[model samples]
Target: MKTLQASRAPRLFPLRLSFRFPLAALAVMGVLFFSPAHAERLKELASIQGVRDNPLIGYGLMVGLDGTGDQTMQTPFTTQSLNNMLQQLGITIPQGVNMQLKNVAAVMVTATLPSFARPGQNIDVTVSSMGNAKSLRGGTLLMTPLKGIDGATYAVAQGNMVVGGAGASANGSKVQVNQLSSGRIPAGALVERTVEAAVGAEGTFAIELNRSDFGTTQRAVDAINRQFGAGTAEAIDARAIRVRAPEPQQRVGFLARLEDLEVTPTQASARVVVNARTGSVVMNQAVRVKDCAIAHGSLSVVINTEPVVSQPGAFSGGSTVAAQTSQISVNQGGGAIQMVRGGASLSDVVKGLNALGANPQDLVSILQAMKTAGALSAELEII
Candidate 1:
């Protein structure tokens, strides 16, 4: 019995050792399968060529303001536009009439004509005051013709301006919120003409990536081919792809299915965008860093001025005079040099920066210096 028990124990030990190898292999496979990068839909990553929006602009006038309109004396264009409009309505004012208009404001109307928009389709419009108007609140925009870059009128805009802000002034002291000079009107312009598109016109449609990347373009092509058939899609360049599609009538359904196909996008280039005015810092996942050191400090200067009155004694002949006294002081913050190890990932880079106890503005300065020193292996953009 003892011999059999010893033999069974030895066999069980080997079985346990055999299981470890498979468990280790699974752990490694799990790590590879759960990578941080995720698959993205083609529609979100690219746009179909010839499918875009057109910009429309026009000059217009706003009326019925509660004494917050443009000053006609300063803005001659406003008075001219009003006069021209009145004349068109068969009401001509005499020459040198010296009309003092207070409720009229000159404005520029703008809108975006979406792709495939048909005539009579209502689109939103934006009205911006072109003159020195205090506010556009409680004002109605006149009928204005909106023209595209081709110099053809495409739509007409007319509606009441919806101001986003309000203000009050008394004795030259005023308070305001948001913006009061510009406003938007929903469904304000009726499309007068259509901007033709040639989507899949010649049995081929082009796709343009939002960002140019050869690997991503190839992946997109591969995805389309897998869903449709081999040789159905071809990569034109890093930014565009050409695909053989169905006829114009069936093109919409084909594109609908193709856009839903998911493909793993290529890794993004390492980059850091900095907003100088807002002190904002944004970095993508691919950002990396080499070993570096940073030291930051701040210096403050203060100056104070006080008026001192010099008085003479009761019987003295000296005159009293006022003298100015000034005091100046400077304070320098303590600085420490910190060692930062090389970072292979974005999180590591963030941790390294956090270890230096630097604020956003300081981080911007440090990043710029690091980039100059070649420690940062990423593009830095400031806007």
Candidate 2:
């Protein structure tokens, strides 16, 4: 079965704006772009259409390492695996045999199952050591079959691994650049089985948006209907659209025609995304702000430390004793409260924050508080 028919791939939200430090580009009224696109329900930029790829993963091993493989003694799995290989090669070690190999490591195999991947097609794979392998440099991945959750093997992988960086250690010191425990095997896997195709069927086909938005879905349906004639398409929800197509025999041709049609979809909802850990803020063009004033000030905190000495009491046969003590001090920072003017555009908001000279991380909090106060007109999401 073609994955294109029975889709196992899941969708994800497309894009988001940041609240911490959103790029400020003023969208003036009636600007050709800001204006309702001329091709209202039929334009490329306004529509979301594409066949997406899916993810597939498997666990396997990497061999031929340069003495950097997993310490087999510590990882019994590695030792056991080595024995199995020896036996496979027609070599037999006595019972309770032990091996000290330096070129093997148990690794996890991962690959992306392309949309509609066919059997015998080549796909790239990544090999990552699961055990405490010092490095995966100069290694080769053995034959590993990648399978789906259904335990059906879909691909067979094997190739030389390419580690992006190098590292070295000597005299209890080490230096490295980039990671070495993981490596990439270019076009390492051969598709053994294809995921069934499930999309294009009889006269009608269903299109699911990456994100569920009533406006976008309706626009998509309208655009499709306009191209093929009225009633050709219908919106089932903010996420799915059902379009009438040719009979079973013509489904493929119908899809080809459908993909090329342009649709000026309705604008996505206004939303701001904030990544607190990275101090990143993004805001979509659709976002706006309510008229409001902001007063931001920094409270300072200071600390001081000092050392002290103490003398011991006199005693008949005792030498003088000495002790040490420490002192600490604190101070709070102060700054003049600055007033931020009411803002209607992204530029205004950025200008206000720049005036505060607030760092990215701190700005994240400020934007969240603004949203909470109903001063910002957009959904705020933190990730």
Candidate 3:
């Protein structure tokens, strides 16, 4: 397979939480700012066509599972596989000998042979037990051929599993963290074949932008045409741009130069994404708010229990019974609605939200209401 070779991009730290004291946390809770230039770049949003790695997967067997393998009676494949393996090793078992296995497990192995991977090059592979095996913590993968979608074998994986987790039990109960039934074997797979990639064979080539945006696509085309000529680059669609390569003789050299030319893409569309489960609110830099009024207050509904005992008429073999009664009350706390005007900056919006001092989950519902009222200038997407 093709082993893609490219310089690693610089690490980007997401603007999440910053260490601060309690008071400072409240002070900066709603204030937002974007002083960093090119927080996200156009190149980051795009990708080159035919420059992606392929996913190759195959089924294999794991041996030596410390008696934690699947029950042979249920997973018959384990017994059949073991018998076949033994026969291949010149150890034929009697036809009447019913075999039960406790150390063999069927597993699936997966690996990604990066573009331009050469023959005999080792790559890491993930071996995941697929049978009812309790754990693949200490097992060995047999020679398994990883194949591409075209059904062509590209790599061979075989190695002792390197499970980075451990678990033990005294009784029948089990407790595991992370994963013990799946392990990774670093550099355990050897590339047996290479995928042919023609970056610039005859001459012409194409660049595929990861995101489909007409404005971004047009800008990319313009950038390339400026470097070459008007007819050199053309936008095929919102995602793909075709560029006529240099003469066939200078194809490779031409591509090498083109990749380094930087072009700034258009600004992304305004959008806001909301996570329903976590109550997380994420908004793009372009997101804004219109004039609106908001008043958010917590409504606490509490139920308290008071246990009481009831006694039957004394004597006559009567027993006393205990019962619990619950008392409920609702506390609604709200104030006059605050008027928020349009063209309000993100910082202003943050200030208004922080004033409410609502919990994270409550803040989500408030934002949803604001979005539905057309006061939120960006698209609201809840996930």
- Model 2 C-alpha lDDT per residue in residues 101-213, reported as the tens digit of each score: 78889998989988778988999998888899999998888888898878888899998989998999999999999999998989999998887656644545677766677
Model 2 stretches with alpha carbons more than 4 Å out? 1-54, 88-90, 247-249, 309-337
RMSD of 2: 13.9
Estimated TM-score for each candidate: 0.86, 0.80, 0.84
Winning model by lDDT: 1
Worst 10 residues of 3 by lDDT: 15-24
Better of 2 and 3 by TM-score: 3
User: For model 2, what is the C-alpha lDDT against the true structure?
Assistant: 0.71
Per-residue C-alpha lDDT of model 3 across residues 1-383, encoded as one tens digit per residue: 99999997534322223232132243233336643234234346566566779999998889887999878888888788888888989999998887788888999999999987999899999998878998897888999999999999999999999887888887787767778889999999999999878875656678888778887788777777887789888988888888887777777666666776676666677787767887666665566778677776778899999999988996768899999999999999864465555544555555555555566677677778988898887887878
Estimate candidate 1's alpha-carbon lDDT, on a 0 to 1 scale.
0.85
Model 3 scores a C-alpha lDDT of 0.76
Tens digit of per-residue lDDT, candidate 1, span 202-237 = 888899999999999999999999999999999999
Q: After superposition, how far is residue 146 of candidate 3 from its true place, in Å?
A: 1.0
Show the lowest summed lDDT stretch of 10 residues, model 1: 9-18
Better model by TM-score, 1 or 3? 1
> 243, model 2: CA deviation in Å?
1.4
